[model samples]
Target: MSAHTQIMATVAPSARFDPDLGVIMPPSNGMPRSVFGRPVAPLAKWRRRYAACLVVLDFVAAVAASRTVVALFQDADAGFWDQRVLGDTVSAFVLVANIGVPLLWLVILAGAGAYDRRALGRGTEELNRVVRANIAMAAAVSFLALGFKKDVSRATVAAIIVGLLVYTVFVRIVARVALRRIRRVNQRASQKVLLVGRLADALAVHEVVTRNAGAGLRPVAIHLPQYPRSGERVNAPVPVYVGWDLVPLVQQLRADTIAVCGPASLESYELRKLAWQLEGTGIDLVVVPQVTDVTGPRIHVRPIEGLPLLNVEEPTISGLSLLAKSLIDRIAALFGLIVLSPVLVGIALAIKFTDPGPVMFRQSRIGHQGKAFKVWKFRTMYTDAEQRLEALRAHNESDGLLFKMRNDPRVTPIGRHLRALSLDELPQLINVLMGQMSLVGPRPLPTEDDDYRGDVRRRLLVRPGITGLWQISGRSDLTWEDAVRLDLHYVDNWSLVYDLGILWHTVRVVLDRRGAY
Candidate 1:
């Protein structure tokens, strides 16, 4: 026997040491002990399935679009459908273009993040991206048509564009609904989640995961920090054990995946050591970020000389980014004004008739760079609600400088419902158009609020968003510390992709109507 094995055998006569679980206990001998028995490879399977679905959808959309274009022209000129033209020149061109367009579309879709599972069935953001990509593709095709002096009919092209848009959108919507249902079913069937972190972090992680059953994680057990065994039960619906016992617990629970939310004090060397030990095990390890509400696109992993370097690019909310935001805001606001005119008129009439005050409420709040700006909202509260604020301060449930009360008596009946569903914030689309706010950014804080701190004040770096990370991530239910952390995370890692995600999630959050007030 090797010296290390001899030493271990001598130290524990009847025991087998499990490196993953850090346990030096009795061996079950010929009896198989379940250690690290989860199906980690299944995630790869799911990814493959997801990619296949996307390819099929893309192909169908492309073929339908191409056929529609061909049919439109063929109907206009019956001679175009004949064996001579169709069999040779037209047939060859259509066949090549049909296949080429789908392949090119797949590349464009990948670049636009259309296939990301996290983005499936999210919102209009994905649709917007699809529209932009299709427009670019159309432009390219138009340029080719001009260069070649091709006799492509505008009606055919238009039909193809419309058909592709409808097909892609319909397929995505159906996919999202189906996936959500599958997730719900999976939760009911019980999937195991192995949580690896300090006790405190593990408990918090467990709470969130359990609360959101749709998130698809079931905490089977927690691997606590190394050292003296606490022999204490965790508050979660799972067992808590010292780090050394993790491997055996994983096998016992048949966990599908392991999520590691290591403590802030965890050393990189220790993490590497643990990773090495778990390398061959069929358990998938996912590292949870200490920072919350940050999107993936904002995080760049650079390998320099074999070391993984995490780069967090500072958000550029000014100059070109600001200009882009301004353009989007104006376009959206103008569209909203045109599309929601009836709704706006009704709201104005109701407010004017029900209350003696103006239909709109304009309040001074901190904007970009601590600049004061008047923020507009459809008036939902009594005109004297601000004057009555101090008396209701004791009822404030929000953790930071912000004030929020789910059951505030000062809220008018109309205002309460409006705020519940975020209808009160609709007028801010105008603020967005005016360049005082953005479609997606940090929530603007009132200058008078005492909660603004040193780093927290960085939220002003960008124009306040009508709907932001905060708005989607529990809003008033979030602690001040959590709120600030999320805002800073956004500032550290802002990207067009991240912004689109926030916008997409915002729609879901609004529809769910959880923690809104």
Candidate 2:
């Protein structure tokens, strides 16, 4: 094999790796020693410290926010104590019963798996969970007020909970930012993982985990049980740990996690045995489903008498859910248009004055139910963009399905910034308002029905979105496979909560200016 092929076979897929006991051992296989330059910190210690720091920050924020709310109420309503909502005979203690609000809030968060080791540094899951936990806390507090004859001011309580939620989320986000810095500046803080699956499955899962170092899993080795006995060195990326004996190699490599990419390597029985082996071993077990790109909230595991089944709910397109989604799309679109009126006018003027073309660029795009509609956007490209497309085909920076090029010559100077910031698509709000699109759904591709295939065509079931999973997740930078997977997953498991989560992260993604081009 060529030298490049040899290295590709065993490149020691990275993270904080032990130096002396290197992954992809050279001598044992007669191959060159795989380069894993990054030094590693103990995964156990790093997780513990990060989790502790976040918990401490949460406590501090809770106390500070609750106290501020109390002080504000006291100042605004001097008669807050005397003007009891319950009755005249209520005690001061009853009115100020929320003195333990901080403690209660912290406890609720902890109980909700906010500080979970698996959850600590994962992408966006912790923040989502924290919000849900606080919302639950608010509901519980409201219930207590109604059930018990408490004299607490409902307005004051609501303000305090809302304030606390904001502070708590802010603290967690800051903590996450710090953790991300550590991972970036020093890769050694990441957890080492051993991947076990078929070659294709393992590589796919490894790519995802490697891309999301914020998730804290760094695969250092691959074990292909299905294709064992080829050689001491199985020709694959990362250190190919030969054989189905995963439990032993995990200990030998000091691996913190054993990620089963699919159920292929270890069958159901063997998986159970492996779990039994790892009992009390402190080794994390992560399973990547054969079904890809699905989010956590949609997956439900239930045991029916003696059998466990994984139930994935189909994406809701009918009933009250769809109605509510439609309602939200129109309402949010109208509000956005109103709020951004000046900015819209400015963009229109810029497009008209700079480029000798119409203010709005409307092009036919496949929309809901395989219907074609004109999608609206601020004209970022020149009037002759289509004519120049063939010449620029060679320089297409994005995956081939979507024609995207960074610093394309056809784009106006102002259009570069617009596309970078995703402000170019702001006029899609009109499409959203007209029900041709949604505030959040899969982006409608400009493909004919003849070109649309089986599962891919399912994207047409709902109105095309201005921004959805595709917009927040790397945009044009994602591989065609990944882009399709994300869009299909979103369409399959659409939820109001999931849509809001996407919208929230959309802000962060835009700010990061990553993969925007």
Candidate 3:
């Protein structure tokens, strides 16, 4: 074992665990002599401490971004940064700013819990926290200036706010990516979890944890309370220790967490007992709620009269926010079409001249609430392509419900380049203006997919998007189950910040041209 994993050997004598209680009884001091019976890795605690380093990095990024923005416009012809603050020259103003700005921003981030380990590596929540903190910092500074009668360039402050916010988010994103990569490299960094539940629940939870490598949960073993001590065969690949001897199993396997998935073999009282036993054992106890695919914002845990009551708010794509979304879509789509008018005309000409077919293909797609719409796209396939689809069925390469071929013979030579660059999907900006689609949403399904009668139909709750979680995830390459899971996750967890995050990822995915037809 690595020296880092040998700390357990220096601890006190081990306590014999009661098999029925699943934990060693606390000694006179009311604490177990040694919670970790074996060499438990220090990585779980160390990861939290790693956040301290990010605080320094964030401060540096804030200062750099503030200085760069000020320097850019300080000498501009517009004279934007010519104002003085309280008889102070621009130098003194900058000096005060250099010290004050980073400190306030760091304080805001800290207060928002952005630097917390639980928030790190979580994309939407972390980004939302940072963005909200930045906005709040800007508003407070603006108010302070007005109230104190501080003369300063409003434009300079605005530019600094925008620049610092973007730069800080970029720096944190880089940090999160680096931390994830580092954690993956060190096996000890991953959470070695002991799953205690029914066989079915164990299998399901294992699948979720295994598939989501970024979740950082590694199932070391499974213990089904429903099974006997002799043990029954577990459907999962993990070893099934078939008793409630959680303390011994946790210690022997060096597990840091006991993740209980829903109420299965264990009742509420049994769960309470298990929590009580693991209290002084130092093993983290997490109960995975039965509500799956819900976003963090909607899942509120309220402590009500000593019982934790979970409040799952119903997700709504309506109200003023929905109106704001529609307005944003219309405004952005209009601006994009105007700016890219030349490119659109060029694509139209290219398609018409080379393919000798219509520039746009309108297909019947199921939209919000089973509403049908003719979604527009720059026709990448030849006029006779649909007629020939049956012939190429055997060549379909998509692992999902959608039919896709890497090199479809129906595509024109020019069409391949357009599809590869995602230029073909540009025409859907018009759909955005028409209110038939949003800038981001669940991708509209073809009418043929209507046969899917599962909760998959819930996707129709919101207007279909030109690009969405599936498009950003893997598109045609994703398994049917994965594609459906992502779409449903989007449906269940849609938020303004979540939508922006998806839109951001969609850009990267499109630029990479992955999983294209």
Candidate 4:
């Protein structure tokens, strides 16, 4: 046999030679026989367990929300439906809803793809699905009540739906956080990934994989289509393999995932053959697309004739969403200014008493479409802070356009606490109220620091924010490039859901005071 033929046979020993196609057919048995004695079951088992755990959690949340609402907000003797029509006892009707709602919740969650293994452990997609499911459940309840002409209390229904929504989202977030923590600490919980492609492409994909430890993909080895003819050294972090014998190697390593780094490196037939070899082995095949940075919602795969084409939708810069964002920002800002007025007064008084300067500080910042506006903040520095900037330039700790110092002499004692807790940023609500800023968007940069060119200028596509991806991500600890990248990512993937998520995390990040100056 030729060397290529011998390699092919080695790769798929169970396959029979096919005379028609001039190749081998996959094994007749459904499951491919592993070169090693045992199959990799942990990969599938753990995922099933995780999904089951989510099911249990969702069910619990549903029961608690419904029961608690019926207990507190609703009277126990009150029947959900009109007794004159259904002729059921009040207690019996209450019991039925308390029992039935949770079961229906699980069904809807499953239908909404909340328990899909792909979204179980990470990303906001899981939470998004959960939220969507909750909304659907609420609508379903409303429709049932109205269609039956049942005398359901609108207040009670609203309480139950709102309570359930809050509880489910909370538990899911907690579960995801716990799962990620476990995966980061325990390698066995993660999937063993075998990267395949050209050397450069494999290494690049490895970098991306390693960066997201929470993703549960542990790269254990790399496979090249052919040995390098230039005799270059293999410097990959994982063990490197070459040529065929892929099935044997996969079995030996017990890798449950085969990530194709660049499909362009492999011939179409070779890719198909690899897929054939992995059939029914429970090894996941992942293809890394050449397109980078774009999120899943924007990318749609359309099959034309026989070829699958990727269609990337344009980023939403203006639409009903942006209009909603604008309205929410202003209303929330106005409400915040009113609710926090007491705290705001106290801060102003403290600043006036201690610092003996203006209570508010405003500086020119570049906002949406490069428009210059004054960004407001509580004065957290001495009156002569600007004058001191020139001298402190030599002691600058930041590795970017912004100046940062761990312990600057300009900060007053009260300012230190304000800065740490991010209370100094509260007055920016005025900016949001004035339409100069948003609750969540790219952080506005000082006009003098506006070196924004190329793709970096995309940050100006939307209104600047009082707090944003950069503020919650690392604050001043992130380098200029990292900050810019995050802002651009937020711009490209802007959604109301994304904004709400950032705002939610901002509370925790503020309390933790991570990366705070």
- Highest lDDT: which candidate? 4
lDDT for each residue of candidate 1 in 127-150, tens digit (9 for 90 to 100): 767777677767766776689666
Question: What C-alpha lDDT do the candidate models reach, one value each?
Answer: 0.69, 0.74, 0.75, 0.79
Candidate with better TM-score, 2 vs 4: 2
Q: Identify the superior model by TM-score, candidate 1 or candidate 3.
A: 3
Clash list (residue pairs), candidate 3 = none
- Model 2 earns a TM-score of 0.82
lDDT value, residue 6 of candidate 3:
36
Tell me the tens digit of each residue's lDDT in model 4 across 1-517.
Answer: 7433453455456555433323333445656454345554345678888888888998889888877776664433444633333464766656665678888888889999999877786668888788898889889888987897766777777787788889898889888778777886775567888888888888888876776566788988777877555545556566566643566566656778888887566777867887876776777777887765677589999999988899999888798999999999999999999999999999999999987879999899988888888989999999999998999999998876678999999999999999999999999999999998999999887755357778888888899998898987779888887788889889988889889988987997899798887
Cα miss at 41, model 4 (Å)?
Answer: 4.1
> lDDT tens string, model 3, 178-295?
7666656674456789888876787788987776455577887677675343433234475555533566557666778888877675789877776776766567788878886786
Most TM-score-accurate candidate: 2
Candidate 3, residue 295: how far the Cα is off, in Å: 2.8
What is the descending lDDT order?
A: 4, 3, 2, 1
